[model samples]
Target: MEFDKNFKTHSFRATFITDLLKEVPIHIAKDIVGHEVVSSTEIYYRSSLTKKDSLKILNSVDTLRFN
Candidate 1:
């Protein structure tokens, strides 16, 4: 709730944006942050990776395969 004034904004912003986009829907995040609309959240956040990036990681894991 409370953060020091000298705390690194870039690190905090990166963590906040990553968690916002990669974990939950924009609307839900907007609500959590008291934004009136999902677009407000989207304007400030973006994903570092696409769905294809996630699929590539999943494919590379090789923990399971269809027989």
Candidate 2:
């Protein structure tokens, strides 16, 4: 048997997931990536929550508190 050059593999899936995470919301990403459910996308493709992201949230809260 021969494999096609366009065949999907684990590394391709990983790259797709990473791009989706960077570009789209969970629900949209799920659909584009062919996940049956949002939970699956959330479980599989979610990026690590970062301190910079947290800091942005905290700054928004701080601004709200002062207004």
Candidate 3:
């Protein structure tokens, strides 16, 4: 597939880190990227998530079952 002209190598890094944040802890992602602060990593991290993404996450939560 042809990539958008604006896409760059750093874009791949951002995408990779963003996907990692979805499945893993933020601290883990911070260490992986060697960021001095989680907030620094968060700048890239937060932008990746969308409203639909938030809904998907919320929907994935299993409702409490009464025993």
Task: Give candidate 2's error at residue 47 in angstroms.
Answer: 2.8
Candidate 1 CA-lDDT value: 0.73
Off by over 4 Å in 3: 1-4, 46-67
The candidate scoring highest on lDDT is: 3
- Candidate 1 scores a C-alpha RMSD against the true structure in Å of 6.6
lDDT of each: 0.73, 0.79, 0.80
Model 3 agreement with the true structure over 1-67: per-residue lDDT tens digits: 9988998987777888889898889999999889989988877753657899878777666343322
For model 1, the stretches where C-alpha displacement exceeds 4 angstroms are 1-11, 50-67
Rank list by lDDT: 3, 2, 1
Worst 10-residue lDDT window, candidate 3: 58-67
Q: Pairing residues by index, what is the TM-score of model 1?
A: 0.48
Model 2 Cα lDDT, one tens digit per residue, 9-46 = 86567667777788778788888888899887766663
lDDT of 1 by residue, 1-67 (tens): 9988888876675568658767787778888777798766776674677899989988877656632
